[model samples]
Target: MSEAARETARFAALAEQSNVGPHTLDQLQADIRRVVTTYPSRPIEPLFHEVRELRDRAFNLLEGRQAPHHTRDLYLAAGLLCGVLANASFDLNRYHEAETQARAAFLCGELAGHNGLRAWLRGLQSLIAYWDGRPRDAVQLAHAGMEFVPENGTAHIRLASISARAWGQLGHRTEALAALRQADEHRERLTPDIEHDDPGGMMSFPLAKQHLYAGTTHLWLRDPTSLTHAKEAANQAIQLYQADPPERRRLGELALARVDLAQVHLATGDLDAAADQGHTVLGLAATRRTESIDKGLDRLARHLNEGPAATSPTAIGLREAITHHRARALPPGETT
Candidate 1:
């Protein structure tokens, strides 16, 4: 191009001011980080509304004029906010809404050219599929996430772990174990984000949650050979959860781990240990209840009935307790 044309273009670009300033972008980034870090442990209803408002604000900003870099930043924030909304909908057992939000989030990630957001959105979609009784879909989504490995994030590890659980659910033992091993390998060589502040909570897959995932996968495998592995993993998850501060502990995940531990105990004919785990899960207040946790409790109750202790008073009482516990919330909602 001629120098005259290039000069005009450069001047035009320089004259185009962004609707949002750097401080605005910084504030949006900070808010996104706060939501990402706390959503796993906080009550969902309020966070749901907060995320919705933040996402709407981002969308509105995008509607106005902005520089290319600022537009990308806004898109990234909007994408993450949409992801949190999807997660909240999933926690409330609204699968359709969750998937819809996930799709929007993925689109935002694409617009922003953010591998981390895109990969994490895929994992979130897989999780919704896994819980909504679609193991095949879950596995596919997890694989799709693998296509966009971020430079430094746990999304890839989370994808593999999610796929492992889905494979186990489908009784694909070899595939399940392979996925688990892949996740472990990723973790061993993981390069922490340069600042060591890779968003914690739901965004990053911690070791405790990985162990919990393994326990769940083993339970799905239902193989006698893997029962020992399952028990050990579940115990490790429980210990790790207890080691964290009470505020940081993911209660629903911890409860599900306990329920899986109980299942293993029941399978091994250790009725007392199973009952202890069952009681611990049931102790969680209804306000903190999650759909996954409810299903785990129901699974435990069914396991009780299937075991040799089906006719025993302790088994009967626990089964009845689960029935009542489930009744307390009917299907647990995001709002208390």
Candidate 2:
């Protein structure tokens, strides 16, 4: 080649400046997955800072020039970070903040044209609405998510399961059961494209988690007929969680499942079993605790004042223990 052509080639290769390196992007992606996967097992406070740092890094790069491919990657990573933040906020009982974060994440999904991410974000928003006592809104969000229908993975199934729970809360048995059936159909048709679900962790809806949601849905139906279904589903969820490897065990969800089982036992007038499960949930380390656990325990405490079991020492003791647990927990929406 001519000397001028060689010189031009050398300059061109040397002049490609990037705001972020490929290796940095790779490492950032790895950390995001790690945070996503480990969230159920560890405390959220420390991880909150880690996620913020990672997000800030991505956001700063986003403001600078990058190839189209790198921009998409940065947005995806940033979106996942926002999602984790949303979940953490919801766990802390900051519903408004959580919704804002989910919306931001959804925008990132749009930028990346990632249907999987968009679908999952809708599910997250639905969950927040359900917990915030807006079941009707939750159902609407789930239906909207159905429009995305990811090419692979269980995002749609997650939406259906969430819809089932929301419908149950609204006391629409027909709609709730239909949503449950839809979830089953989605699961049966799922193609396990690891690439579809993106950063998994809590984002991926596994069978065990699905069963837990089913149990909650049945419990919420408030129909005498659903009590048996609730008990069976809750027990099955517990068994599945126990079968997972230690690292993969979602202790928070397991505790929630046990609380559901306990509530079912209460509904059936089985005070002893209820008390047993209640104590087990209360024994969970602080790090593994979630907002749902506290709410479940509160429900148990209220129910304890009704039945013949109300006069029992076990019932009184459980109420006292619940009061103590709530007293010790950091108030929601606050930080240490």
Candidate 3:
């Protein structure tokens, strides 16, 4: 080749190498971790800006990569950003948008040869399906996620818990219990530093989150001991969340756990405790009224109306307060 052509080629190759090198990848990975850590405790709208920017940056970097290793790292970084974007969309109740982002994440995971991220993508999809009122689809997605995550880790545990939740919602008690047991078994096998590639916050399924799921599942099971088990799990989750740093604590999950406690108290005929707990939850920040927490409060309200508390003055007053809180919690343009 001519000297000028060779010089141009060398310059282009150097630029590509510098762009996709380990230092750049590491920085991108750190940025993703920051996004994940910041998401749980804040509103999705602002977080969306950061993740969207990161996704775009990743795409630009990926387009410039030539080597296989560089491509893999860039794909992983891009996949993580897409997953975060999908989660933020789900939080905003934009299920179709979330699915589109999730599909993009799945493609990145596949291209990156990262089964763990792929499994996580499925888990995110399953969560969206569950909130969309498609429990069967959630179950199927969880099963698919499990196939990608063959090891005993947080991702597998999350899939098992998702399965349990779907089964519980379907009123299949035995299946739900079995799935919970499977999750417990997997939890026992997790490595000490399981957060190796998992950036702790939303991506890693910690014990507290697992307990939250267990509590919710047991509430749906509603067997003779289910209520008691549900209360215990919810209490554990609350304790764990309370101990976390402000950034790590998931206020919405904590609120849902409180909802579980309130419902269990109501079921056990402790009207005063139930009412007080419900009042406290209603007084929480409006941002804590995530879809899951809203649904839990609805279930609590329904139970109060349909059960013996239907005519009690205390129950009636509490339920009215809850309704008002929910109305106030609606999205800005949603209030009629």
Candidate 4:
């Protein structure tokens, strides 16, 4: 099909999927995939902005705060948008923003009576908590979300991703691996129809993201298998990012920096290279609001501290940049 025709078809599919009966989540997911694949140029920012407006309108309508024509679907769309925005913030290394957006998304989903979306928002919250260095909280949240929406395929995937990371953080290698396996199993069962129904509002949860999560989890476990998974995910993400618009390139860069640093350190035991990438992460973090990226950088920093390598020039430069940024944020008396 022609590009424009294909885009139109994809969009129509998304609308149709969104209008599907509540129980037909698989069809909903298929529509989401069509939208994601067809609109690679669409940035997360504009999407979130639109979602924020829609959410406001939906809440107003629900509370008799606005026009009466608003429906539950508006609320659902808002929740989805909020979730996507939170994910975007996480991608940008803005943890605080991610947490706020995720919480808002959860609240909106709850008010909308969208249990599945609420579960997904909880998963995002768990991920943010994990990145904030609260593994136990992350685990609790993930488990709670899983319990709330046990049959939701998207929730299962989200739970698996967070569970793997949280377990790895707690040093539960077997549990982490099991969770990773569960995510893989879900992926295997996934069909194009299912992918199109993705209700996350953004297409962040692809196979590459699964691999990236698995690789990072193994990295935390200090397992040799991490290198292979990281390499593959990094390569695939790179290719996809290259094909994407400039605005979306940051996600790929962030992911690449993460896997590259991890793989390089694993291969050469080079703390300098790891620190360099960690520095890159820090730089990216300053501009974006993603807790996950910041967490990854913090992990790399810890690794560097544990190792014996002298801080490379790159590392020192990054440190200087971070120091300056922090100083700027400090009150005058606190600056010293």
Best by lDDT: 2
Ten contiguous residues with the weakest lDDT in model 4: 327-336
Cα lDDT computed for each candidate against the true fold: 0.85, 0.86, 0.83, 0.59
Error of 1 at 184 (Å): 1.0
Q: What RMSD does model 4 have?
A: 11.5
- lDDT for each residue of candidate 1 in 1-336, tens digit (9 for 90 to 100): 699999999989876967899889888888888888877677777778888888989999999988888988888888888888888888777888888999999999999998888998999999999988899999999999999967576888889999999999999999999999999998887764431324556787888889999988888888787888899999999999889898778787888889999999999989998998899888863546777888888888888988888999989989998998877754444421
Off by over 4 Å in 3: 1-18, 21-23, 150-153, 193-197, 329-336
| lDDT for position 146 in model 3 | 86
RMSD of every prediction: 3.3, 3.5, 3.4, 11.5
Residues 197-291 of candidate 4 have per-residue lDDT tens digits of 34432434655456556656766666567556555655565555556566545453444446455544635576555555555555554554333
The TM-scores, one per candidate, come to 0.91, 0.92, 0.89, 0.67
Report the backbone clash tally of model 3. 0
Residues 174-247, model 2: lDDT tens digits: 99999999999988876555434657788888888889999999999867779888988999999999998888
Residue-level error in angstroms, candidate 3, position 144: 0.9
lDDT of 4: 0.59
For residue 11, model 1's alpha carbon misses the true position, in angstroms, by: 8.8
Candidate 2 residue pairs that clash:
none
List, in order, the clash count of every candidate structure. 0, 0, 0, 21
Global local distance difference test of model 3? 0.83
